[model samples]
Target: MSISFLAKHPVPCSLFLLGILVLGHGAYIQAKAYLAQFLIAQAWQQTLDDQQVHKPWQWADTYPVAKLSFVTKQESIGFKHQVESVYVLAGASGRTLAFGPGLVLSGAKIGEVGNTVIAGHRDTHFANLAAVNKGDLLQVEASNGEILLYQVVNTQIAHQSDTQFMAPSDDNRLTLITCYPFNQLSGGAEQRYIVEALYVNKPSAI
Candidate 1:
């Protein structure tokens, strides 16, 4: 190969070389981490747009957008909703970006009248969540350009089998759940990091 060609393809060649080296040592995990960052970034924007546009409350009903914060080093990534599901897991089924990402939680579907629960992976995807804390500002932008702000109220670590994290509530609340320990390497963990957000108020239509 020409020197110029080698120079131009350095990154791709280095990535290929690195891939071969780390193929067995959490290669998929590392790759997924990089992909998850991009995927979540895009999903965040789209979800916010759609939420503001349709305002799910107008037609079928949906939850507000989710936002990332570093207010607490123990909180998880945040999102909003009206109700909770059973348990959320990460997989390959939602929107596809590069090489088919997967169905990561697309914000909690607005429930009738309760807290909306959303979940994701902690170590890779929600690593930044560890900095989220009470009183931290969360700005969820809807599809229709509406901005929903939330305030972090609490943080906790629930058991792996704990379903109370997804429980219903009397107030318009938001819950973010992820694997506990922040940086688990054995895949599954014994606990989950939960961030509780209280609805502060909606910002002006954006």
Candidate 2:
């Protein structure tokens, strides 16, 4: 098109350009997220199979730490049904959370006797948590092939200043933490949504 034509059709041309930009931006975001998930899944597989840290890429800063699974039950009969799982990385840094949940190294190991805290972005890996409730069962599969079971005991919302959630406990526990008000789009949320689970039993190896 000539400069004169574009100038004469400024409004239509501008609208068309804006539509293209919007579509391009949306596609880019989706593609980036899909690629991240794929790499994270590959690293998780290697970690589980080799029982060692596995980075998604040559120079990646994070590695898979554990695999977490939640069983979805039927609402009518209350029978166990589908199960969904996700790989957890080592650090809770922004870079790590972009791919999956992160394990707090200072906390207890997956099968140990202390509070094991896992943090994830509310809108990503932890999004399904909103459907979780008390009594739900969670299976934490360690890199060593030991599967530890946990029963959700409670769910609460606490201020960001509350350190009780992170405190050490005598009994085995698993805590899932995410920013409160899951629907919020802003950063630095002052509250957190906590899901606490108690150790149940460790079944036979997989």
Candidate 3:
């Protein structure tokens, strides 16, 4: 309809404008995520192949530090296995987490003899963590080309005030942390869902 006509029909015009705004916002969110993933994937591949730090962009303060992967069993008809991989960046800040999980700097380096903690957004890269169970195997490919294996030992929900989650340890461990209630869409989630995995063995490749 013409501008004058739309102005005359206030309710319908308001609804139409709101619809457009909603759709536009949704598209923007999707586009941002797609672009972030695209750039992160490129950096990840470069890091893996070159064994060097690769940033998604020149201005970015962080780079892909490791690759995380796990195998899942499917029971559709017969048993099938599917492998999923995600690149972990060097920082867990807002900008870094917009794309993928980030490696906490204070934590132990990947494949090192201490706790390695990684954090990701619950709604995005870490959504699959809800499906992880004890005994599930995970692979972490360090930037140095070492592939370390870990098995989930347990899962827990802890308050954000808990300092033990970030504590250093003597034994090797990998901890994946995401906001609790994976389905929540709000920001500043208070509780964390933690997946603690024990170091098992090193593999040739992920």
lDDT tens readout by residue for model 1, 43-79:
4455554543222122312222334333322234444
lDDT, candidate 1, equals 0.53
Error of 3 at 7 (Å): 3.1
Higher-ranked by lDDT: 1 or 3: 3
User: What tens-digit string does per-residue lDDT give for candidate 2 at 1-206?
Assistant: 67998999999999988999999999999998888778878887877787878788888898887889986644442425447888888878898888889998888877889999999889988987898888777888888878778878889999989979988989999999989899999888999999998987632211
- What's model 1's TM-score? 0.53
lDDT of 3 by residue, 1-206 (tens): 79899879989999999999999999999998788778988887888787777888889899888889965633332222447888898979998888789999999988989999999988878888999977677788887778777877889999999969789998999999999988888878899999998897532222
What TM-score do all the candidates reach, one by one?
Answer: 0.53, 0.88, 0.86
Q: How close to the true structure is residue 27 of candidate 3, measured as C-alpha lDDT?
A: 100
Clashing residue pairs in all predictions, respectively, total: 19, 0, 0
Q: Model 3's lDDT to the true fold?
A: 0.83
The C-alpha stretches of model 1 lying farther than 4 A from their native spots are 1-113, 202-206
Question: In model 2, where is the ten-residue run with the lowest total lDDT?
Answer: 73-82
Q: List pairs with backbone clashes in candidate 2.
A: none
Q: What is the C-alpha RMSD, rounded to one decimal, of candidate 3?
A: 3.9
Top TM-score prediction, candidate number: 2
- Report clash pairs, candidate 3: none
Model 1 Cα RMSD, 1 decimal: 10.5
Alpha-carbon error at 86 in model 2, in Å? 1.8
